[model samples]
Target: MPEQGMVIRGGAVVTAHEIKEADIWISDGKIVRIAKDTLPKATGTTVFEEVDASGMYLLPGFIAMPTPSLYKRKEGQTYIEVMREWVRSGCTSFVDVLQLEPWMSRPQLEYQQTRHFNSPLDYAWHLGMEAAQLEGRTVARYRELGFSSFHVTIRSPEEISSIQWETLWQLSASKQTIVHLHIQNDASVKQEQRDLIRQLWLDATKYWKVRTVIADSSAAFASREFDPFLHIFRLPAETTDRAVRYMYQRFYDSCPVASPLQEVRIDCRRRWCPPEMLLCLLVRLASTNIAKAIGLYPQKGSLTPGADADIVFLKKENWLTKYDLSTILNFSETHLPTSVMSNGKWMYRNAQFHLSIGMGRRIFDTKPNVYVI
Candidate 1:
């Protein structure tokens, strides 16, 4: 019998496939029950905190993996300030994408320590790789130091052949470490270069048996043609209605056949895409698919029983009613989460953070699981 528990009642729970009215009971930092009917009276064995979630949508908290093309830190800004901005946007998890170099060791450690001591959100690190870093014992050293994933940036065909592909393949295969490829804008435009990129993905997935991802830094790649593979798109810390419009436009341009309503929605009185499509793009692909690509699928991306209780509660009326594109987009982009729960604890409520600074943990995928191809 758990000593502490909470029941969130009467909210429409949004799962990956469907949204249904359900009551969620959380205990010990995990979801314990999702009941369609009202729960029976509790025996005196458990102390329960009850929350009314009527007229709200209870969804998994957003997870962001940001990769800045330039590594310049904003003047006078601290990592905690950056994380607080993300938290205000309903993001619960972050993965710091870094460039690989011996000189970066100190700064990376300092960043990790700062996040550990000042931020109130979970975080991880993904290191960008260089050919020299692929030499003897370097990859092993990263694994020992708790680096979560490796990133590879390809600018030209010569660079691809220059890398010791076989070595990276074997290391990733043996350790199940995720390898992310950033095919730069110029390289992605050429036919021959695109072919090479596809071939590399085949080798990584088929021959090496390693989980791989196509990391899109600028979001412009969403409007380009590329081989079918797992993709992770970067999102700004504090998003806005204009940004949402730009993102939807990119997706519409890239996959017009897939989204047949692009023309009608774009030309509608709203002058932007439907809010549902934006939600699917930003929440489903950005948060859930990225989680799956990084091998943190069911644990971080889902709200099923037994998963971590990282949740965001949003007012249904803000998004479901008839409104202009700017109005609807603001619900998700500009408006803060009405309430947020991390690890079964109330971290944010009534548009304010409730958790203390440094309360969040550093999360990583220590045990890599099999990914469906």
Candidate 2:
């Protein structure tokens, strides 16, 4: 039997490169077509439903960057409430960073899975393993279990030498495994030490050919050498010279911006970037770029044909008066999404939720091809 069909019309559809008025046709949880004219109705077992988007801007639903504690239920916050906040802020998918200690067992993994059973958003897990945990077959073992993304924390320069880069490089060269490096910095660690660690990884990319993402390390934006294999997750603040250099370097092609909505909201309030730039950054960071980074590109981060029908609707009233493309600074406050859909179904609409406890599923179960860009 065919899944229900849907036609979302009367709105401007935002794509990776452009925004234009279009009607979206959906069936079986995937976009079937997008056109300027109304699409034909479904026949047979498929029942077509029409959603009048009227004055809205249809966007690919926001896909949040790696959230370290998203799985841990916070005090005074129910799991559903936690996920509901994401939905309220327009996130339809997210990447969770799961910390796995060397001694943790399979049950620990299973427990993590159960923690998100009530999630209203689709999510994937990036295993957080320590430097010592990278051993013979360890990455391969996790790869078999549907984890291709791994993160490691480096607090010192010596720690970089201890990592089994050969094993990671081999898997990356073979299976497109991604290693996310978080170079920890504080009063204890000198700026020179951090720079050395970044330089070491940058130098390693010359020979090892390992796919690596520098997580939340803004200093990477100032690297003198550009390595195709090295991607940075942090986007320098728009006020900084690094942000200008970042764009001048065209790093957006390979470096996806990683930020949670709260930080984005704060940035907006600060008016650090012009609203137009912020909107573009939001779509790239919150949608397209992160999707590509996690290997869920066109499927999760796009609104084109064959992409998942996950979307968020921004109303016409939210635009700033001066700039046509500018979204108001209080976007999260005054312009939260009017509706959100996941897998072609309405998860949120008109200040109400239509989500189920287990409706959200792990994306890796389908085994998406690893996208190197």
Candidate 3:
């Protein structure tokens, strides 16, 4: 990781904006300025290292949802899945979101000793505290073991114990805490349950309230067309009574396995939304009269001034239309980057991953989607 690195002559200067031909100056892994015109005094003769990003979409590196098994992902096994593959997908940071019982695995111990040693990208972890285990002695032990935050996931029917909620609230109030709850499947419950959860939502804010992230209730929330194969979580409020009647009327029009409505209930997908789509949605919602601040929406998601300098340089014109803003509109689903940086440090480039060195054991030569143990 260089102390100062600048990207010279990039297309659309910063990937988040829609434009062409721009240059950005970065210092200490942070982008300080962008110019569509020319540099100012002492700029061209500066001693900082620079890279040419001509003809590419210089976007922000991706941040993935958390997972449980990462603490033990590569420990005691012939590894198959490498973190590098995910980095090649233009992702720079991944959060480990699991209800770990304040316990340490061999991998966690290994990672603790070697995380900053270096290899691919930058990363962090979010401590998860599930409702089912909130009251247990094991959870208390783990909570005391110095975790960063607590998440009360509502993936199932939530409990109504004020005792547990108070404990979590206390933890969050200490400023060492962040909170996130699963709302995607909340719509599947009865109306009373929905009202109860929303009522309890006020308690979630009683904490210090640092970072909170939420996701789509289902695939239909984002899909342009209601493809049953790409959705899940049916809510009474989502469809109107008229649509219900119409749906029943069409029930006899389809076969069993091929039915469209049946298909919408199984689309359990994640991280498929393009970075631009996510950004545009955030910008749109955050700038509205009502300003729908969705979860811990970031102020900026790229190597822009006054924000984190996690940047991704991608070429969309190969499959997408080159030299046109069409790449901006239609490239959301496909335009992953060839290079990615986190904190101004190169994490991915040319199909190679740069994971933190000594972080894990690399026993498998090929990539496997599953990490056994």
Candidate 4:
């Protein structure tokens, strides 16, 4: 039997379908029961820890799908510290994208080694693919090693040749692997050159016929709809009101996936979105929608019984006001979670971290949906 159990009482539990007041019971690192107010007594003597969640919104923890290499530890900062920052912001799961290196393998052991095992979070790696890595049985090898996705950054049309597109299509059709594409403006390249690359993407999508994600984009392309292809905008760590307006507009109009990494800046300070719309976007759309887009739904994105206990607790008092669109968009940017639980372990509670070194685990899709070409 597991050593600990917990009961969170009197909070509004938010699930994908709806939100309702309930008490949650968790044991052995999984949610065991969910009831209106309290649970029935157990047969054995088990002292479960109790947390009063009255007047709070209990939500599934945020899943951050950050651009590879966006986070680099500042001078003298440790890995645990960096991860703690994520927990502080309510993220319990994240995707770690790494640049392709000659010695890299499907699982990318070197990158995995950097994860703090004692941290109270989970992560998965997506290896960035360049030209050389796309050749031969590379995609097959990645599949064999249990990778369900690959990352590719396109800066020029030359990068998406017929052969490259064919390789990507074959992999997606046969192996169900997703391709995360980052389309960005290259300062070194001329405008016409960048335009040509954008044109290639618009044209290649019709042929690829695979699940592709526009991982990051500029304002010009943020609102453009790419049907059958999901768009996940990467918000600048410090951005303006105009950028926030464009991002939120794109989110509602285009139905793109959102991540916690797209933080906004006001008065020289970085913060999360306004409380009024934060949960709807960050938890519902950003976490749940993105998980489904990547084919890791229900398992990673939900808070139902038997789902992984990756949850975030938010104070109700901080959010109860109605705000206009600009107030909703331009309000402070940091949404600090009151408490965070990942895989049934308390990662952060009452603004304090309860993590050790090397506690975080790797997450992967065990039964990914196969996409037919």
Candidate 5:
């Protein structure tokens, strides 16, 4: 009854505890069936339409919360390229971490529209708090355009007191939408600043649901601002290979912050987080099962029958499947995700979906294998 092809038999099926072997069948853009130790043969199945995913890690797609970072280079990535990576890297959904700046209103809508076509991944956005939306029609316009959440940056330059902070909390709580803030970086502010931040957090919860998410932690590491329990030793810049091995225990396959930070994100900005650190964040997220606490539904973080089959199958940079995503996000090194799926479409298959990647393949697909590579 569905439109897409089926995927059968992956060796490593992601379970609650570990990866196990199983047969998975997808239809209607979702996982229609999954079982172990057996296969159901059928007639009239489309030829070459099913993938025998043996030995492959059939992973649930990743969900990325945005970090006020935008790609600065215009020609660097086209819409298709961005989406391709989202899927190829096994990311089915992403939230744009935005700074509520001047263009936050108009561009955000344009961005959502453009990105929807660019990637097969589901995209959500969090608005960075600035008073600017109050003066303009930005809020009314963008809110109607589907900007459902607002992330207020608490680290303000002004002298913010506890009572005033409580007022800000009340204001956001009354809005009744998702309210989250950035709290991770402390090197830039004094202890008094940290205390004010804490006060605001407490009061914010009094009125709002108290949602929080940090986009990355490497910046916090540089600032020595990671929470004590969740802190990781800074790898030496000089010896990455040696350092990576040593830091293994300090890291999980995924490294989430202490449970407290799950309720509140400390760092709100997405500046200078290279690929390696991104991988660290994902590993932490996967390890702690933090998404379960914050997610909207059950069976998330999965690609199982009856789960929201938002799946992403990516081309691993190190060609290491069935392993954690540490290799890509740890060294700040850039690698292509190469494929992406949202609910279940091939957003990016062989390579990047951006214009650059698409144009090259279109012009060169006719070439022989010898010259193509």
Candidate 6:
């Protein structure tokens, strides 16, 4: 007997490129077909539940920026509560950055894996380490264990100078690991010194040909010496300055190269950018860009056939309303997902949740398509 499936009919499906009305056919946790005029008949035991989406817009579920833990039960919150909020807000997955101290054992990794078994949203992990760990095959061993992304925090220019750039870059490039260079410093660190460190790191990464993501860095957009091997992740704080925001917009507009310059923050309440622009930015950056950065492209962040059926449905009336600073302030409240689906199953619908604790799975062994976006 064929398995049960679903047909989400008459919704305007939105992608990174365009929005079109289509019926999404889902089976076995994947989107098997998407068509406008007709759908195939369900025969044998392949029963398909038809969902009326006549006045809704379907979006690929949002993938959040890298965070410490998206699955673990937080203080004063149960796993169900955390997941419910995430699904209601249209977020289906995120990259969890596992900060590791030196000399941690593989048992630690095993424990982290256990923590995600109950997660409702799919996720991946980025190994966060200090500069000292970059010299050896520390990254390679983790890659062997199914990790393809690693982030190194450089707090000072001295830290950048101390890193074994050659060894780190060679290993990363050879193993196809996405290296995130996060250059953050304390208030005591002078702006000049901070800028110098950013320059130094950029120079080194460009020279070494390592695929790198410069997280929370706006200066990368201002600099004209753009490298194809480098990606920029612009956070809300970094984009608050109008001048920096203008530079980012210009870079995004003019840069013909596909460098995957992406934004990690989407502030729905902000009036700095026009509402329409902000909405478009949210869809592109939050969903599509994060997926590409984490190497989970069409599979996780898209509605194309063969992609996972993790989807969020929004009411057309709410999404198409007039936008202004006052009305948009409650944007999130207004745009709460009407229904949410993960892996071809409806987890949230009609203001109710149908959750299973161990529904989510870990995404690993990814090869990032940095240049795709």
In lDDT terms, which candidate is top? Answer: 2
Comparing candidate 2 with candidate 4, which one achieves the higher lDDT?
2
| lDDT score for residue 115 of model 2 | 74
Candidate 2 error regions (>4 Å): 1-3, 66-68, 74-77, 217-224, 236-256, 265-278, 322-330, 365-373
| Clashing pairs for predicted structure model 6, backbone only | none
Residues 1-373 of candidate 3: C-alpha lDDT, one tens digit per residue: 3243565565554332233467777666566777775554244434456677777766655543323335445452322244554556555544444444547674674455343234244444445655575553443455455444345555433563433555554554443343444543545676666545543543344332323333323322333422222112222223322222332334333211111111112111333334433332222221110011111113223445754466667774652443223312222234456776766667666767554554422211111111110
lDDT of each: 0.60, 0.70, 0.42, 0.62, 0.41, 0.69
Which segments of candidate 3 are over 4 A away from where they belong? 1-4, 14-21, 40-46, 66-68, 75-81, 102-119, 132-146, 153-158, 163-176, 182-300, 306-308, 322-333, 351-373
Candidate 2 has an lDDT of 0.70
| Higher-scoring candidate on TM-score, 2 or 3 | 2
RMSD to native, candidate 4 = 5.0
Question: Which residue pairs collide in model 2, if any?
Answer: none
Q: Which ten residues in a row have the lowest lDDT in candidate 3?
A: 364-373
**How well is each residue in 112-131 modelled by candidate 1, as lDDT tens digits?**
44534455776666778754
Lowest-lDDT window of 10 residues in candidate 1? 255-264
Residue-pair clashes per prediction, in order, are 0, 0, 12, 12, 28, 0
Error of 4 at 302 (Å): 2.2
Q: Across residues 59-117, which tens digit of lDDT does each residue of candidate 6 receive?
A: 88887553445534454356567667777778777677787776668997678667667
Q: lDDT per residue, candidate 5, 274-340, as tens digits?
A: 4334333343344123333233223345656776555444333343532344432331123344444
TM-score of candidate 4 on Cα atoms, chains taken together: 0.78
**Better model by lDDT, 3 or 6?**
6
